[model samples]
Target chain A: MTGVRRKSGSVPVSLATVAAAAEVSISTVSRIVNGQTHRASRETIERVRGAIETLGYRPNQLGRALKRGESRVVAMLTANLNNPVMATVASSAEAALRAAGYVMILCDTHDRPELQDEYLKAMRSQAVQGYILVTNVKSPGLAEFVARGEPAVFACRRNPYASGAFVGIDNVGAGADAADYLWSRGCREPAVLFPAQSSSTIEDRLAGFSMRLLELGGRCSKAEAPGLSHLDVGYEAARSLLDRASLPQGVMCLSDQIAYGAHRLFFERGLRVPDDCVMVSIDGSTLSSWLAPWLTSVRVPYHEFGRHIVDLLGEIWRGEASGERILPHAFQSDVSSDFE
Target chain B: MTGVRRKSGSVPVSLATVAAAAEVSISTVSRIVNGQTHRASRETIERVRGAIETLGYRPNQLGRALKRGESRVVAMLTANLNNPVMATVASSAEAALRAAGYVMILCDTHDRPELQDEYLKAMRSQAVQGYILVTNVKSPGLAEFVARGEPAVFACRRNPYASGAFVGIDNVGAGADAADYLWSRGCREPAVLFPAQSSSTIEDRLAGFSMRLLELGGRCSKAEAPGLSHLDVGYEAARSLLDRASLPQGVMCLSDQIAYGAHRLFFERGLRVPDDCVMVSIDGSTLSSWLAPWLTSVRVPYHEFGRHIVDLLGEIWRGEASGERILPHAFQSDVSSDFE
Candidate 1:
């Protein structure tokens, strides 16, 4: 058979030539090239291998794609593809998806609820058998999809709209844990930083921590009303906490993202973490992990979130009720845990 | 007709209910829900809209999944979902795909050539309509896939393994341009800081800069080859560059990532940017825009790359010759004729 001709052109090397060099059938050559296992015995594999060594017969993905219609593909959706936490999740998810014989199509919704809704419909048009939604989208549309038997799983944030099964840490319990830790470490007044109206997870966090602290008997006064998870909001919240002079001994941020912004402000104001003011956050992202002495964070088994989502989607595709599979969220404290 | 039960649980209103309330058909409700220009007359639209509003009608994507027998999901193969560059590309691509009624399932191959093979098979099983391989994978398997009519559009990174439609900047030219810029600024000697062989794009950058400077009657050398495209590499590379007794007056990097790294190292050592060692890099990410005064870079239009891939995929789906659509490498410099 004719092979791809070289641009410079002498006779282009062909599979036939490789077959001739290896003294095997063209079928055998093709088998080795295609990475087809089982049919070829060890001797054939060895002979073909020897032939491949001589002919440099590199099997390619482009050819396999033609026979298969769609090259390895899976549609993956997340809030921000760039978010280090999500990135880690995507990386791990890719590995798991590949292992399960799937290719992923990744999309970043920028955490936009409306955009998430649009993407849900758009995903339908592409015929994706499985999907993973990693956003704080509170759209009822998504819940409707899940109710209708769409194979999807939620990560990072849960869908308040109840579109599909969720595969995330117990945000509410995790936030309560964060609060308990901060308060236990000699913290009195505190704040829970998060966006206004993201998902039930955010509410869960707020309620978990505030209610826990309230139950623990700390007079809780919210210094800042909930705001977008912007660095500005974090900075301002921290600043106001300082300005009020009634500064709480600690502030519980909804996520590592919020804490990062708040940390900068805390640092610039000549306040040391855990010393002048104690700060705690969820999400063990690289940023918080690398923060000077490192910030205390709740490690939410982020990578596992990916694996669990894949497992859930697979089960769902097989018509199983995965129900609501929740991942374990743990608390981790390091050198940054100590407050002066 | 069953709607998502709100937290308030008001019998879960839906579009069907809205239609029932408005005494209209589901198509009319769908028209209102989709916001199509196929007008239902102002009063009709308003009545339908009012009923929908009162009913809290949210479009359920999963409801249509059974009828369509297609999830309309696309698959994406990404090299690095953690990288800001990759994330930006993902965001744009996701938006475009969604706009065209497609949801992307993203997988991060972790820049592993071996995993690319694993992912290829996965794509096939998913019945993905197309795949967007976003990698700098220069393995032979890539060529195999392209040869097979896989309906693939490369988002960024070209691999020697596959030859077909690709979208990326001229890294080599960009490097050469960096070299030229440094040379023109009275820098007799310049060294390029580059990532190692993990990425072909970095290799391309180094090759382009090294060859161009060598041809331009100057001496060029590598600063350091440590990690991937990052400020970390630049930092270590800067250490090596500084360790050299005869340091080059200007430093060029394969990417803004490396430049940032090197910048910090120089700053740490009491050297100022451009005053002692001018730094230039490629991939004008937003970090380059906001970090300090400014870092000279050859910026790639990331969003355009996303757009180009989608447009190409659309063409391929429609049986167009998208295989030949390749974007030329771009070079941006402070001394361009367009520069003010």
Candidate 2:
């Protein structure tokens, strides 16, 4: 059989080549490529694998998707893809999904509840096998989708209404850890900078940080800003907070984006991090450590979060019990106080 | 006609309601919903429009996609979504596409040629109406796809193998501008840090920058790193450059990710930015401005680039001539010396 030749005089690897080399039917190659290894004998699987390795046969996912009700496509939805933390999670999740013969479609909800519904309905109708949401809270169609016993997992953020598998770091614990670290460094006047919109993750972090700080004979204040992108909100919050005569000695930001904003404001106002104020935040993004005064953050296990989401999906597919899978977080300090 | 009530006991707006309210056939409503309005009479169109407004009918794009070969879906394939710059572009592009009744599917190619080919094949077979690629350089199947008269546009990066519409900022000009700005700020010894990959975008910028720096009577050195991500590579490059003892007065990075890495290395080594060495890069991301000693960058018109991609696709679909749409870039100086 003649392989399809390109204008550049190169032949792309095809399943036909794999089939011929393995001495198997094209359907056999397709089945194996689509992850139906159990149907084929061990010898056939090994032969196909050898052929695939030799030819570098990357199977076209769409053709296999058309053969059954399952499209072998999963969608990962987030409130905003602009968040580097979410981007990191998406990168890992996409890699995992692709490795398992599934194509991942990323949808940015832009933190709109209506857009969330629109995406869910659109993706659902497009025959996506599963969904992993980074920020989902009482989405319009989540209940019905959950009621249908569909495969779904929440990553990073959770919905109070949905009883499903959740793969994320412990926000509350991270918040408490931040308080402990800051207070140990002699930070008495502490404040939490978080989004005004109430999320389980944000609320938990704030509660943990505030309660821990308050319990330890330290005062905690709250500075809330509304919006998804934390940079602007964080800047605005820091501006207002700085305007007040009594400034917080320590600031716990909900995210790195917010912390960056505060960083800008502090620097502009002739204040240095951990010198005038100690800054701690969640989501250990690359940016968190790449500043003049590096941020002290709770490192969310983004790679593990993605892997666990995929693993939990596998567990659900295999009829295993699925409810909540909480990943761990680590406290990293780049603040000068910590070093001192 | 009765409406479909969801688990929340709320009636979701349906096409059936529109059909009944307009006293028109369901087929007519379907046609109008699918944008085949030329087939209907003026009265029918107005009635359907009125009814749609009254009933709030949101068309199910999937059913229509199945009926026609054209899908109301466009895919944007990128090397990596972890780049905040790419995220900004994707966000704006998705918003533009969604506003125009097209759902955007983001596929991260992970900067592998094989993965790029895989994503293109998968998305193509899924019946995507068009594609907007963020980083593509001589992929195996892209030439054939373009030759087939498919709607495809290159964003941020370009491929010489494929002749298609390109959408991005003037990287060459931006590079020259960076050189000019640095030279004006009294930077005689300049070093360029860029990805080693042979892409038109990177090459153009490097060429423009080096050429301009030489013309301005300033010596410019080059450091190239091989990878999709500019962060780790940038850090490594900086470490080596700083160790050389004879360091460049100004360092121009190809992207913000690279600049961030350099920022970390510089700060860790106690080198003052703009005082000891100035830092500048392209892709004006949030982190560029939000950091303490902010990154001076060439601000790519991300929103306009996204909008123009959609507009170009529309023009192509309407049988209009499409070639290239170059957006403008701005030089943002936050390297401290600029302010002085």
Candidate 3:
């Protein structure tokens, strides 16, 4: 151990080098360095200490974590950070995690399954303690990770293929609420605008809206466009709906961005909102209230999502049973006063 | 070395156990397991291999990474992930990093210096290969890290206390352009709205706007409110502005969100945009185009920021001279066409 030369000038002294000098195993040196010296003999611990001092080896915090088979790091995989709702959820979850003494590693999957799979593999290799998936993509790697009973919480979006702990508003209930509100506004013919790419959130919302609208003795037509961005999808869907014979009196946009896009098209066509058509959307994001035509939306309670998600993650860590947590939602509209 | 028993039944067999069974150092065992047998004799390598077979030790990928003192991971520290501009920058950078075979770790510093310092220390302890800071908080730990010549790229927000590679639009130039645009619209009296919490981006923009407006013979007044979110700042600033006896003919908002909030207030007061007040703002984000009143804005090239930031980070890694990369900005306004 004493006669071994340095690997090279560029390489820094490592734990392995200290272990070699001490003539002890790497874990023994690691144990001594990390102050877990209960198992080591006094002489052995002393020799390892001397080797560490002589070799100038600095123990890496990450290496120490690996030895303990855990890290205080949580990785959150977001489908699209560019979306305000997704951003709000991610930001809240990050704050909550930080308060709980964990650092969150956010990865924007960009709604691509391949990218999601890649990030999953990369994050797994880094040994993140748990995962917060705001993405619905069920990559094979994610399935295996979940099947292994790893600590994970599905936020905003859920993997339909697997049962896991989920924290989000009840999209189906929100959709029904939206339908009831629009129906009460004296809209016999209503329409829904959505993206063609389906997720559990979208499907559930659509289902609830359709079922409730039907029960209310009104039929709701749906328009969908194939696009990755909600804005483009809304624009295209609105255009498609406009090509028909007549317009729906009430419109329900699945998300705020979709509403924004559709509103832009409506403005271009000189069709004022609530004058030509009343509109309601989901995801009561700040943009929903800040932007003009102040969308009356079913608020998803995004601010509260962080605390719930982090708390659920902690429970999972404690070997608790995984379950769905449905937060409350409500109708919010600054423009409602004007209509009333 | 063989005398060391298994640490316990709960602990899985680790590298230390393999080394002890082989009567060799942990580095030797690691090297043999990783197929780096150049330094070890054939017998030593064979013994380590046999011990590995007997102990059933599965090498951890993260442990291997620590041994190499490198991980293909990049960390991005963002001030507020909820901010659309910051979100766009982060999402774009993530895609760029992924394409380059690197995974990005995003941490929302949330504009808190203590949080920024904590995240910096945590990420450094984890030994991330580099850092991408979309935040401007100059923590002492960050100062030392930058002073050490660590590979760091300042994206969108530059560090005032340190000289580092920066990738962003020229805020001063962008500000001057906004002033010119507002002035060209026949506005003699103008005002700029910004958040009270000043950063280099905000200060430089304010400087440019004030200087250019002065040169144009129009003294621009400024209103700022102490708030963390731009929306609140804009609303409060607008309220303060409206409390005065008069209003500025031309208004400039430092960010799109500020414009959004101020516009909401103006709408509440039954004032019209471009009619009652011609407005121009920075961050020609999608919302700027999608939202009504159709803000005429100085469009920052956010989508292109990712390529420039990642490439600059690569150059820094290559020991190249750190320099500022200023991307181009342009005037984008669908509303301008209507005015003309």
Candidate 4:
């Protein structure tokens, strides 16, 4: 049995108390308390208002019930925060989350599935209302866990089996797009190099590119570098490819990191990009623009994608209907023979 | 006059009831109920525990006075999440907090003091057991503002006034160490370049280097480029620094960004690092090692320093003495250099 002191005052009226008092949803209660009007019915509003008055429930998620009058914290769980792509996404996600009167709690799972599970458990333990998953690792528990009625969303990578909430570009389409672009650029025989990491994700991207290249009447050769080869795997693979008796007409790298390493090797070997060899890679990183005549690349919509994940999570928190969300990937194809 | 509901009945048991039943100090009753036990006498503990059991008085802050299984959540506030050093520190702090079974609510204030203030208010409102401030912009409210007296700790930046608890490297000493190493390597009459961002931080580092240079009988010239020149202002600064009719024999860039630009220029002009133009920087970014031949840099004590910040905050939360925590900076002098 629990009771509040009348002398000191009833336990500070909170959102939880008000939601319990009103026969309405959390988002509905939040909207009413925040003075937002739109979808709420007159009868529902009247009932909620009546409950608030009788219970003397003061809105707490605002600045008043709160001593300082603000609680705009947002918690984001990112896969591989060390990866520059995810880092870029997180940077933009914070920007958008802040613009929407929310702060972010960024958790980097280091692309470990078990660690991701631990973080999820921790988030639930803390009652974190929103979640953004940015990773390529496939975890069976993730989609189910987030889908089990929570304010959660996925970014950058999506689970094919789950439906109801995700915001990301078409990785497969992007891979195929790269292949098509390379083939169209007068390349007859193309070799694809992907670093071995996150089997599911690499497969998705590679499948997309492979499908397109085969359809475009171009021969496709695939190379998967052994061991951990994120970002720099392409360099080693490229060196080995060049040292081989014959070289493919063009090279397609999995990420900009691998491409960067390859570029260095080319420089070391007195070879220029797109001259002795035409190169293309995904992710328009900061270095891509600075490299000599610049790289022919497809820029991941990090800014938009990041915002989409956060915004979708907010929608879920606001009690939007459950479902899958796939954001479109904007392609940057301004790569000409524009090398100096 | 807050009270607890009775186990057998609905009637409330007040603090006075416990005090009367225990025949002890009302202050003692209050302290035990609130979970503070440092001042309570042993006999008083037995009396208060017995009284609380008899009267069934429940404490709010001290609610569940048992300490062993108590799980806490610490809200940590930081400015730039994208900055590698800050990112590493946060990662380490989160690990430490997690290992201790504490949830870390990380909020990025994004260099906005107003937002930082708002976040402080939010954390207070959330009733976070404690807070760890890792902000870029220093404010008066930072060192203090613990009205509820919830423990507060700082990381990275320090409270130079020596008022608040701090866990960071000795900025001045790190600067001096970098300078001493550079000069000992045949670098003479070195010029300094900084971000021109925060005068306090810039001056702190520059002063240490300048003081040491003067002590070494070498004249130090300084230049500050306005705006975000560390990244963009580099080329111009390098051009000006190098194009001068007479230039300093060596250069010390305040950051790897500045050093990268300067070195790029040096390369263009056919000058070599540590040979014709010895270059050194602080905040050892990954760019330092990945660059060809690497860069001479002063690596901030990230691992050790990060661990200390979390440990200090833990100590503060545990009701230990709260004071300034001056951490030592580990200097990595082997920053890829060739000296006589």
Candidate 5:
């Protein structure tokens, strides 16, 4: 122990070092170290034990967990942190995990399945306790891990194949609310500007809005944004819409980021919100109000989402439940009240 | 090994389990497990080895690193992720660390020194190789850790006590540029809206702007925002400014987030940018251009900062350099060309 303590600032002492110092077989040394002395003679045990004390080697948590089967660490997989909404979710999730005595290691896959797989593999090798996903798309190998009875929770997004706890907003209902607001305001021609992605949340929002608008005797034209970036898509979509002979009286944006882009284009084109057209979007991030004309958005209930995600995680942690919690959404009217 | 494998999904195999299976002393088992077998006899080594295979006990990375005295993980401590600048820095830093074969763990301090200290302790317990700080204030325990010869780097902010590697921008120069632009636009009276914090960057920017404006034959008045949230501060500051008999011809905002709040207040007061008052702020985040009549800002060299931070970390990792890198800031003028 004195020798080990003296060299503490240098490389750690290993089991082999102890065995070499004790003049015993590695197996006999392992038995002596693990307290299974029935096989080892007393004299052999003392010598090996003395060597361990002399080496000052301590067992690592990872090795110790080989007996516990769990590490006090959780891996959070996010598509990207560039989005303010994702940042909010991440902050909330991290705080919750920390409070629960688990360290969170965040992995940004940059919306790539390969990266997600790589991170998952790394986390598995480390034997993390569970996973928390803030990804919109399905991650490879995630289903297999969950199938093997690993604890997992999906926040803000759904996994079609996994049977795990989920906490998210009602995207379809939020979309319908947006359409209802525009239609009730006497918008006969409404348009949908959505990113070209297969996200269930985005699809549900578009579906709910389209269905509601159609029911209100309005035809909703759909325009697909060209890229994954909400801002770029909104800009490109708006540019294409401007090229048309007629513009829609109302536009429903899929996200606040998209709304910002579309709003910028509208401002540049000398069009005013609610004067020439109106807009309703989703994801009521704090930045939603940062723009000149605050967006009329379906407030995604981020706080609620954050709370329920942790609550549901507790359920999974305690093995009490593995179900979905669909939080509600509300439409906030920050756009001008007057209608032509 | 078979015994350990059978209970793999349940519990891990401990040193004691391996020792009992090998019929050796715990100390002998420890020595063999840690690979310190030089002292162990050939027969004892074979016995301990046989027991390890029979128990199916695998040593974890932490155990392996007990000999190396460090883990392959690096902890990144950030004040907050809500700031877009922070998110960009994190993404770049993560990529850099991954390229160098180190896993990065993110911990949000929420601008709280207590949280910073807590995370620092946790990372130390985990035996992380180093730290990367994105905080504006000095975190407790950080100074001691660096003093002990541990590798650490500050990104976007610095700790006064530690002579560690730092990567940040010239806040004073950026502030002077803002003042110069607004003054050159022939604005005689200038006002400042800033967050009330003891941050060195904010202090330098305020000083640089105030002093330079004074040198340019103009007076600059300052207003402190209400709370820590930059948006609220900007809003409150703008409201107070608007309450006066007259407003300044140009406004210098401390940050883009603050500018957003001020912009909202101005929009509500029917005060248009460039027409009512030209404005300049720090942090050229995407939102800077998302607003109507995009804000003119002292673009933080986030990409440059990120690159240099990683470069410096590489130097620290290689034990080559331990110094500071001050990247220059550029003023992006989108507030109108007539400023000159």
Candidate 6:
């Protein structure tokens, strides 16, 4: 430990100190230490090896990863962690990534484009190997990152502008299923409640629901409002719908949050579910079962998202082309007759 | 990019290549690049500076941070991100840390001591500057890390074996408030439902609740069940209570998730809140208002936790001693007379 000075409680011996002790270049020391001894002479390798042992120089894993232009770190940029749907997706992905020997850095964007951009830049500077974006807002930084062929997988909500790896349920199919269920329940006219800030998931669900409702010879009306949270959006949208006309026989909520907001408004108006208006929504989260009326909604296979997204990222890392993975969805209800 | 060979699409120029081109030690190049040039002569600094420009070497922030034995990264170990309470704490803390110019790496320990240990080791290797632990499980690794004078702040759940900084509501006081509310509702016989796996939060709340109940000349019974999620714990505990004896006139759920599960069980048993039995619970999350019959709860100031925890971490970083910070909580109910 001649060249490397160790204080009572100080930082560990760095590579610079090892190089200095071995009287060789840092690259030579690093190559020898990392087991790339063929690049250096035998005498130099032995000297560096001896110096490493004498100084107890442990290679920093993060520093090594930086030098190799790769890391076992994946960053997940979630729009809203407080949203149960997003939380489930993030937690599941984290577990899968951890199992695959990758540490996940979760960043909550709060559905703000600026925050998403900031996190993307910050994670890039940290040399994250991949990204799992639950992005709803359009972010230029994300689009550029994906365009550069970086390993990025869109979960739950896909970026409309960029064509990259995506893993989620078929939103249109889920919406069509909701429409069919509501129609089979002897409801003709139905109202769909959604947030004003549109996303691919919302637009596709709206398209599928309206198309299927028209095919069933039933008219569908949409109500939307601009709000910070989905709950507020649903509450305001429901208020608008109630203010204009009478309650429809059936209703479709774009999300579980939206459904809760609308249900609260309905409860305030003394309108009961299945008796006054049968309601159907997407996102079969735990909230559906936790609610009193037991919301009949289309269930997204969120638990499977982690494995699928991680597997897709593995493919991307192997120079595979972009792909879309759509998991299966089913209609769930404690009372089956609610849809009959 | 004269000294550096830039392919069509290849890795960026690293510090090693710059050092090689400068014909100086990597430490010299790093020092000059990081504006720590006092250690090197002016001529050597000039050579390294010229090489850096010619090689187009952009320093990796993470690599620099590693060399300095510090990082602007904080790792948060959450018990269960699927739990809305944990989600709120994590998301709020993320936002606060981000505003303070720090990146947060969130890991869901899922209430497993082994997982907590794994994350603690993994984060340590990553050279995270601090930790925010929402840990419930007793982890030996965590205790050792804390004992070694690491910067860690416990959120919501405090570790029984370690003395460290904590930022959360006073669970004992909140529990006493719940008991007082139940007593005011004229319910003499009260039942408290909690999870089988114990944590400081649960233990403190139960202690406060029972102590205050006895002071009020009322008796309290406890129900517990072993389950993976708090919801299942409440559901199974309620079933056990129902099968063994008659339903109590008042029930206290340890958390909002527990309340939802117990309320579902009550609904299934043809009982109603505030009518057949009065109910009170802690964790006044969004779930409280989302439920059909608005749950009377003690609202933990979750939104304030992020700021306080981040600020406390700042104090620890500045050589401040370990301190405990307890936030305030209040009783929330849409109908005040529900307690009266």
The prediction achieving the highest TM-score against the true structure is: 6
DockQ winner between candidates 2 and 5:
2
Docking quality tier of candidate 6? acceptable
lDDT of 6 by residue, A1-340 (tens): 6787322123557789999999998888878877897798889988998998887576666776866767788999988888888889998998999999888888988788888888887887777888898974877876666565667889888866766689998899899999999999988899999998888899989999999999999989889998657877777899999999899989999998888888878988898886899889998776567564546888888988999999988988877775999999887646423221
Model 5 residue runs over 4 Å out of place are: A1-67, A292-294, A333-340, B1-60, B333-340
Off by more than 4 A, model 6: A1-59, A333-340, B1-59, B333-340
Chain A TM-scores for all candidates read 0.74, 0.81, 0.82, 0.71, 0.78, 0.83
Candidates in order have lDDT scores of 0.67, 0.77, 0.81, 0.65, 0.75, 0.83
Model 5 docking tier (incorrect/acceptable/medium/high)? acceptable
Per-residue lDDT tens digits for candidate 1, residues B254-332, read 7676776677667667787888778787877743332233467777788667677888777776766665434554444
TM-score for each model: 0.65, 0.82, 0.84, 0.71, 0.81, 0.86
Looking at candidate 3 chain B, the ten consecutive residues that score lowest on lDDT are B4-13
Off by over 4 Å in 3: A1-59, A333-340, B1-60, B333-340
Kindly list the per-residue Cα lDDT of model 6 for residues B1-340, writing each as its tens digit. Answer: 5787332123556788988998987777877887997799989988888887776566676776866777788999998888888889998999999999888888988889899888887887777888898885877877766656667888898866766789988899999999999999998989999999999999999999999999999998889988758888878889888888898989999988888888878888888887988889998876567564557888888978999999989988887775889988987646323222
Model 2: residues with Cα > 4 Å off, grouped in runs: A1-67, A139-150, A333-340, B1-63, B146-149, B292-294, B333-340
Q: Which candidate gets the maximum lDDT versus the true structure?
A: 6
Top candidate on DockQ is 6
Cα deviation in Å at residue A82, candidate 4?
2.0
Residue lDDT tens for model 5, B1-340:
5554331123446678887887888789888877899978899889889987876565555554555656677788888777777888887788777667667788888777788878876776566777788873665566555556667788876765755688888888888899898988888788999876657678888989988888988888888865656877888899888887477889999988788888888988888887889988988775666664557888776756656776787787776857989887786645433222
Fraction of native Cα contacts kept in each candidate?
A: 0.30, 0.34, 0.49, 0.09, 0.35, 0.50
lDDT of 3 at A11: 40
**DockQ rank order:** 6, 3, 2, 5, 1, 4
Tell me the DockQ of each model, to 2 decimals.
0.16, 0.27, 0.32, 0.10, 0.25, 0.38
Candidate 5 structure quality by residue, lDDT tens digits, A1-340: 5554221123445667877888877778767767898998888888888888776554445554545656677788888778788888887887877787677778887777777777776766566777788773665566555556666778877875755688887788888899888988788888888887657788888888888878878878877776757887887788777777477888888988888888878878888886888888898776666564546887776755656666776777676857998887776554433211
